[model samples]
Structure formats: structure tokens, C-alpha cells
Target: MVRISQQRVKCIGCNACVEAAPYRWRMSRKDGKCTLIQAVEKRGMFNILVTDDEYDANVDAAMHCPVNCIKIEQV
Candidate 1:
């Protein structure tokens, strides 16, 4: 499985993630940060269980991150 996490503090509000992958990313009105659309709370950051269909887009979103806040890992 693929797991995703976002470190909001490192986000630059570039909206790259949102533009690249609207299905899983969103811009926060309160902080203008990029957040996982359907993420669940983990230790601190938001986490999402991703499928193979979303892997590429999510990875593209992570790559588009200006501050490199998004993390994708296999589990």
C-alpha cells in the first residue's frame, strides 16, 4: 500500500498539488496550506491510503510541492 503525509508547515501555498491532483489535494482557507482531501489524522500529519490508480498523480503532486512537504512511502 501507499501512504501519504503532508507537513503543512513546509507548504508554500503554491497550489501546485491542488492543480496536479485535485482528487486528493486541497487548499486550506484558514492557512492557505495544501491538505490531503480525504486524509485521516495520524500522529500529527494527515495520512491517506492510496491505490495504484492514484499513485502517479499523487507522486506528481508530491513532486510539484515547492517545499517538498508531501511524503509518499510504501507500506
Candidate 2:
């Protein structure tokens, strides 16, 4: 499994993440911040678990994030 986590409060909405992984990330219309799709919010952070198929794209998302708010880990 792959875990994607984001410190959403720190997001700059640069769209790098969305560009890297459209399936797992998106631009929030309300705040212009990047939103983690299907994530559960907790303490200003968003998180989700996905299959390994999503790993590479999401890893790209994490690497492309200018603010370094996105993180990915294997579990």
C-alpha cells in the first residue's frame, strides 16, 4: 500500500502536484490550494491510502511540491 499525506494548511497551490498526479490531487476552488483526493482530514493534515499502482505518480507529486508539504510512504 501507498500512503499519501499533505500538510494542506501549508499548500501554496502551485499546481505542481496536480500536474504530476491528476488522479490523486486537484486544485481547490475555494482556496486555490492543492487538495488530496479522497483524503481524510486530521489536525490540518490530509491523508489517504491507495494501492501501489498510485505510488509512482504520487511520488512525483511529492517531489514536485515546491513547499514540500506532500509526503509519500510505503506500508
Candidate 3:
């Protein structure tokens, strides 16, 4: 499994994550922040769990994040 976490409040809507992994991330029309697909919010952070197949793409997303708000980890 893989865990993806995003500090949505810190997002600048730069579109890096969305570009890297469109299947897992999207831009919020309501707030202009990048949204972690199917994520659950807790303590101002958004998190989602996915199969290991997602690891590489999300890792690219996290690495490309300008504000470094996105994180990917093996679980």
C-alpha cells in the first residue's frame, strides 16, 4: 500500500501534482487548491491510501510540488 498526504491549506494551486498524477490529484474550482482524490481530511491535512502501483507517480507529484505540500510514503 501507499499513503499520500497533502497539506491542502499550503497549496498554491500550481498544478504540479495534478499534472504529475491526474488520476490521484485535481484542482479545486471552489478554492483553487489541489485536491487529493478521495482523501479524508484531518487536522487540516488530506490523506488517501492507494495500491503500490501509485507510488511512482505520486512520488513525482510530491517531488515537483513547489511548496512541498504533497507527500508519498509506503505503508
Candidate 4:
């Protein structure tokens, strides 16, 4: 399985992720951080559930984030 995380503390409101992968990323109104488009919480972590087809886009979004706040892990 694959997962993505946005460390809000490192987010700088730069919309790179949104520009790269609007399908999987968006800006949060409360904090202006880039958040997963349809993120869900599990085990105290917020993550996006993506299909294989969406994987590359998500990874690209992570890579494009100027603040480097995004993280990806496989389990």
C-alpha cells in the first residue's frame, strides 16, 4: 500500500502541490496548508487513498511542493 502525508508545520501556502495535482491536493482554508484533496484520518495520520493511476500525480505533487512538506511511504 501507499500513502502520502503533508507536514503542515512545514507548509508555506505555496500552491505547487495544488498546481501539480489538483486531483489529490488542495489548500486548507483554516491554515492555508496544502492538504490532500480527499484525505482521511487513520491511526492519527491524515492521508490520501489513491488508485494506482493516481500514484504518479501524487508523487509529482509531493516533489513539486516548494516547502517539501509532503512525504510518501509504502507499507
Assess the local accuracy of residue 31 in candidate 3 as a C-alpha lDDT between 0 and 100. Answer: 92
lDDT of 1 by residue, 1-75 (tens): 789889777788999999988988888999988888888876668888888777788889889887888988877
- The whole-model lDDT of each prediction reads 0.85, 0.93, 0.94, 0.76
Q: Residue-wise lDDT of candidate 4 within 1-75, one digit each (tens)?
A: 667877666789899888878877778899887777667766645776555676777788878878777887664
Error in Å for residue 75 of model 2: 0.4
When superposed on Cα atoms, how far off is each prediction in RMSD?
1.3, 0.5, 0.5, 2.3
Model 1: residues >4 Å from true position, as ranges?
A: none
In candidate 3, list every pair of residues with a backbone clash.
none
Residue pairs with backbone atoms closer than 3 Å in model 2 (clashes): none
For 1-75, candidate 2 gives per-residue lDDT tens digits of 999999999999999999999988899999999999999999988999999999999899899888899999999
Task: Give the 10-residue window scoring lowest on summed lDDT in candidate 4.
Answer: 42-51
Misplaced by over 4 Å in model 4 are 42-45
In candidate 2, position 55 carries an lDDT of 96
TM-score of 3: 0.97
Q: Which runs of model 3 end up more than 4 angstroms from their true locations?
A: none
Q: What would the TM-scores of all predictions be?
A: 0.87, 0.97, 0.97, 0.75
- 1 against 2, candidate with superior lDDT: 2
